[model samples]
Target: MELTRIGEAAGQRQTPEDLRRREDSKAANNMVTPQEAKERGITWRVAPPEPQVCQFCGQPIQPQGIVLQNMVFLWRPNVRCTCEKAVAYWQEYDRKQAEEKARKEDEERRRAMQSRIDRLLGNSGIKKRFQQRTFPNFRTDTPGRQKNYRVAKEYADNFAYHKAKGDGLYIEGTNGTGKTHLAAAIALQLISEGIPVICKTSSDLLLDVKKAFDNEGVTEAQVLDAYKKVDLLIIDDLGKEQCSDWSMSTLYSILNDRYEDMKPTIVTTNYNTDGLINALTPKGFDNTKIVAIISRLRETSTVMTMAWEDCRGK
Candidate 1:
């Protein structure tokens, strides 16, 4: 009984302390000691390997060379190059190539646009003989001629705005003035700038319509539509044609359609507005139709008086 009591007292005091010590000892054993590592040939410190060579030029890479790893390019990447000179050469080459490509594209576009302008002007029925007439070449010698020339030039220069605002011109005056010359000059200038234009004398247009009625495969609609749809229609010599019922009616239809559509037109006449009205309203046609046509002209057209004496030497 005495031995059992003594052992129980010792056991109670030592049990917790000994259990903690045993746990600490087990943790210490789990750690890798230096001696054990050496015996196992495990290295804790090592020197890094040498840097990679330049894959591009097979040259030695500089310490501060640009380095990109695992990169993808259009032609096989993961490429590293330290050749600054070669890289610069290729960059310049690519830049020049891009510039050349852009230049060619621009040139091609310009040529195509010019070709389209040429075709439109050719098909516009502007007399080939008058193609050379231009505002620059029109005579500005005398005071009166110079005045008319300046106005015509201004009109030509500002034609883009005139077309946009649906404005037109009624260039009328005495016989010797260069009305037709200025009108043709304006037409050619606008045409050169890619504006669609048609030029025809009043008599010629009426003659065309008459020919269309008599000729097979030619229709009045075709002849009239050509005049109606152009961007600019030049009707030269307004009262030249005889005022028969058919002539007046055809003229009215052309003018009325253009007026309703707000299309711009250039009209040249040897008579003033009143004179033109008188010439058109002869025996027994409709005076209202003549009034209507003249009214639209007065409303939309800028009246330009070319008072210059006839430039052509009599």
Candidate 2:
């Protein structure tokens, strides 16, 4: 315990010989200055190793090209002079090495993530025509149009919060009013951030399910799972699809599952609630189920009316 206390008290302090060497290092700056030497605490070497001049600071470096000066290397560490450059050089070398290693690791992670995102976007059903849509490109010519833009942008930005509540956007407008444009823009923004969003017209959604039944090598459950479980599912042109009992039922199934799972769903439509009801009212079609779906949508979505003049009407 006495030896432990002495060692602890001497922690990190230069020995007397090392201190004397630095105190007189000015006189013999470029040549090996002969001094009393000791090896290990119990053994002494007959002579010191040969010295060389440092290329960095032009000072007499430690003997025998010794580079290791760092602590925690208790056996035969190079105890350096104050003006030695190897310490600083190795420090900088370690810093650059750590930075380079971090950069390469980050790039590898980014490439892997990008490949995964490519597969997701390809399967997202976002058409190439709308791939270029973005918030900055959206026109805000009027107060109403500006409000629509603000709402859409805010929704996309705060999507994680709304998604937590299963809340989404219900875009209502006439054709050519840029409803789908705003929806696609939101999807693209989320996609660029690596969020999993699936944008498809309801017709194409039904058609994909139909194809899955034929030879697509996929099951109906798989199709429904994708739509029902995506982070955000944008169903564009909701009422434009030619509705059948089966098609509407399938749509309801997807929406219902998404609702139960508390997943957000964005729907763009050229129809009001009544117009949507009328559009869905086919010959002897069941109205009860469609009304329930609309009610749920009203509860879970923020209604954004984009009835302003078409910004593209130039």
Candidate 3:
């Protein structure tokens, strides 16, 4: 009956005494126990004390021996197992890696688009034409000039006023002074702020206007447009442009347009108001129009006279 019970528990295949005898016989011959088997790096399973068989292979196992089968929890408790921990760690790492990759790609794309826009704006025909046709580097660094000036704070204040207010400036002094440098400095400031500016010597501008008139395809309107639309217009050596009938009219038109639109202009000249009037009247531009332009500019502008030696020469 004991054998039958053992056989029934072992699926009617083996008796408990038989199995014990076999295990005892094997132990006498120095056979390994289940725990010893596991210590010896062997795979095994242990049976319950109540005559239970191995759930996986249906073999009978000794109660005190280690049954080395994979342990699976129906519900997780406390810390995760090795396999679960490894998988979780890998999942989080991969998610963060993907996010980092996506962010880099977005940043690269934005930079590329910005570069394209800058290229388009910088390479426009209008911009190129202005560079080639207009005076180059006429404005020197103003902050440096302000520092060089003995009354730097005062000069800087005057410059800042014109820059912020978009007011016209009249810089009067003898030749070879720093009038042009100051004017250039203001122009640079405005340009850096994304304001469009045109800096030209009076002689060069007059010559260009004359050439534009003489040339078949060029019109006075084209020249006038470039001058009128700029935020700041700097005319250096103002009394030095070759005055003629067409040049005077062109000058009048530019000044009138700026005056009406409240655009700022900076004139650096060796001549005073009276000198300018005398020069303008000779070309049939009356004093009334000249006075109007000067008055408007004076009302909205600040004048700074530099009587020192030319810093350029120094």
Top lDDT model:
2
Query: All candidates: CA RMSD in angstroms?
Result: 26.6, 13.9, 27.1
Task: Count the clashes in each prediction.
Answer: 0, 0, 4
Candidate 1 segments exceeding 4 Å error: 1-125
- Candidate 1 TM-score, C-alpha based: 0.59
- Tens-digit per-residue lDDT, 250-284, candidate 3: 77788788877777787877767788666655555
Which parts of model 2 have CA positions greater than 4 angstroms off? Answer: 1-122
Q: Best candidate, TM-score-wise?
A: 2
How would you encode candidate 1's per-residue C-alpha lDDT over 1-314 as one tens digit per residue? Answer: 99999999787776787889988776444433233434555334332224456645677532211112311111212234548865776688789999999878856754554453344333555677667778877777778788778877877889868877778888888886788889999888876776667788888878777877776765778678767766788898999888888888898899899889888888999987778988887686568899899899879988888875666664
Positional deviation of residue 202's Cα in model 3 after best superposition, in angstroms:
1.7
* Sort order, lDDT high to low: 2, 1, 3
What are the Cα lDDT values of the candidates?
0.72, 0.76, 0.58
lDDT score of model 1?
A: 0.72
